[model samples]
Target: MSSDVLVCQGISKSYGEGEQKEQVLSRVDLTFQKGQASVLIGPSGSGKTTLLSILGCLLAPSEGELIINSEAVNFKDKSSLTEVRRLKLGFIFQHAQLLPFLTIKENLVVFARNTGMQADDIEQRIQLLIERLQLVAMAPKFPSQLSGGQRQRVAIARALLHRPSIVLADEPTAALDWHNGQTVVELLLDQARVEQAVLVVVTHDVRMLPLFDRILAIENGIVQVKQNVK
Candidate 1:
């Protein structure tokens, strides 16, 4: 472990106002160091996903400050938040969310291209990710041709292709069976360690707990840390 990659101080989130108000998260503080992988688990509607979203910079916290790479980000500024997300963070959702019209390899490259990356550099990164994620054989295939596990693997590859310093995965294996779900999580954990990325995953699957360096439980908007099989 090295310097803290992400830090949240007194983070809180709420929705609506007055009679329609909904409080999803209470004051929460967290720190994640490089190469650390954490799994956040909670019951349905327990605000685990909300916390994940705040951490990923997808949703601004109703209150508190977020420091990324030792700098406090102003979520109120869309451009600042967008730039931080683009340069430092990677996100994975429950669904693979691959582009149906493109080949597996193209799906990965298209995203890099959108960032105006050099064509040769993009190709090199794609091949590297494909090999690391063991997606070489499936590169030529389309999303529809892949199994659920395969697609999720590709999603993992796509999220990491940019070599992000922080990765936020929200229920990434929720769509797969036991075998495949475990496989996908294992791959994510392994890859995060290899890249020395700060990975935070939100999931209800307790089976994936042992693989994480730490586990956090959320309930009634409160966050509790649990020491795991690190």
Candidate 2:
């Protein structure tokens, strides 16, 4: 069996129509292996987020085929695409994007609930993930009560709550200071590896670039492999 977790071939995307149409991505081919951390670096408006969205099933490419863990996914149907996203992908945004009214525990459980997981085991898995992510003490706190780093940590725990096969992160460390940013990166790398999932991070920070297994650069709507220093 192939070890590829994500496979994209000749993917293309555009927005608008007619003469106003703008191509955001063009023929982007990529593949990510299980347990590997792939970092995508690019300038603003360079289609890094566009490509990530496509890979995460948030957006459909104009023409291409994507195979996730050997299963073909049609990005055309809205309902089916939503189901695929819920069942197969975990997303971590720049901000934690937690509900201010919900506690950390509630956020995690809510994720499990939406994924059709057993309600009886929600607490067990939530606690386990909180402990694993070193957020056990903050489980009872809401997003407003925690620091930026703590909130991001909770977000990561929530993302992993349902045990998705792939985690897609967008500027995960953009909101933190030096120490906290490094800490978050390390935590993400460790948990992603431990869970045996493919991690694709879209980041502008070069500080954390060395830690990734592979680095790809996006420019002019194209993605090219860059040398990994570490």
Candidate 3:
């Protein structure tokens, strides 16, 4: 089987119409293979988030195709797009975004159940991730009761609980201290590799760039490969 898990072909995104149209992305072609972790860096308004949104299936590109696991995405079909996102993609954000009322384990369980994971399977996955992330004690605590780093660790576990083929993180360490940020990124990379998932992270931290297998930079609506370790 092909190692390629996520691909963007001639992808472009624009806003408004005709004379008022503003292009955000231009022919953004990218292919992410299994077990590869890539970090995207760019100036503010350089379309980094726009491209990530398209990759996450949260937004449709004006022109071009997004292929996930060799299947072309039908952006026009809302149900199909929903299915794609639910089944093939995992996401982490700047904030942990955990439910205030639910405990850590509850949060993970809810998401896994939504993805159709069986009760026994969900329990096993949750146990494994909780231990791997060192979130065992926090599992019974609510999000508000945990530290920022602890919360983000739970977020990582939540994202990987379903074992999605593609994992996308948007400035996941933006709110943490240097030590915590580094730890979070390291854990994310290690877990993604263990899951053999395609990992894509958007960040502005130059220090974190070298941790990824590949570095992609965006400028003036274009994406260029900055570094590749593999």
Candidate 4:
């Protein structure tokens, strides 16, 4: 069986048209397989987040095919894309974005529920994830009650709560200090490995570059594989 989770062929992204057109990505070819941790590094306005968004199904690429878990994304069909985003993909943003009114466990459960997982199954998975994330004691607490690290952990737990096949993180550790940042990255790596999911992270923290399996440096919308420091 093929282990590939994501494949991008001749991927190009642009805005506007003709005279006003702006090309952000050009002929970017890439492949990400299960259990691989890939990091994207780039300068500001280098299309890192744009490419991530396109990969996450939040945005449509102007040209080329994006295959996720072997299913081609039909940009013309919003519902098809929504189904892919909901059932197969997971996203972790720089902010935890947990609802203030919901408890830590509740925040995670809501997603699983929305994804149509059964009640008992949801509970079972959330319990295990929160335990692994060490958020067991903090389950009943709200987002504001937890520290930055704790909140990011909860965010991670939430993202993985539904057991998606591919995980995309956008600057996940950008806000924390080194210690907390590394801790978050380690936890993400460990859980991603356990789940056998493809993990792609975007980061500006050069100090954490050595942790990823591969490094993709982007500048002016072009992606170049720098090195596999792992």
Residue 8, candidate 2: C-alpha displacement in angstroms: 0.6
Please list the residue runs of candidate 1 whose C-alpha ends up more than 4 Å from where it truly belongs after superposition. Answer: none
Per-residue alpha-carbon lDDT of candidate 2 for residues 1-230, written as tens digits (9 for 90 to 100) = 88898999899999999999999989988888888899999999999999999998888899888889898788768898889889889989999899899988888888889999997778788878888888888988889999999988987887777888899999988999989988998899898999888999988889889999999899979999876766
Q: 3-64 in candidate 3: lDDT tens per residue?
A: 99998999999999989999999998899999999999999999999999999999999999
- Model 4, 70-142: lDDT tens digits are 8788988999989998998888889877888999888888889989999999989998998999999999999
The candidate that wins on TM-score is 3
Clash count list over all predictions? 0, 0, 0, 0
lDDT of 1 by residue, 58-118 (tens): 8999999999998998988989888888878888878889999999988988887765668
Better of 1 and 4 by lDDT: 4
Clashes of 3: 0
Put the candidates in lDDT order, highest first. 3, 4, 1, 2
- Give candidate 2's root-mean-square deviation (CA, Å): 1.2
TM-score order, best first, reads 3, 4, 2, 1
Which one is best on lDDT? Answer: 3
Please give the RMSD to the true structure for each candidate, in Å. Answer: 1.5, 1.2, 1.0, 1.0
Clashing residue pairs, backbone N/CA/C < 3 A, model 1: none
TM-score, candidate 3, is 0.98
Quote the lDDT for 117 in model 2. Answer: 91
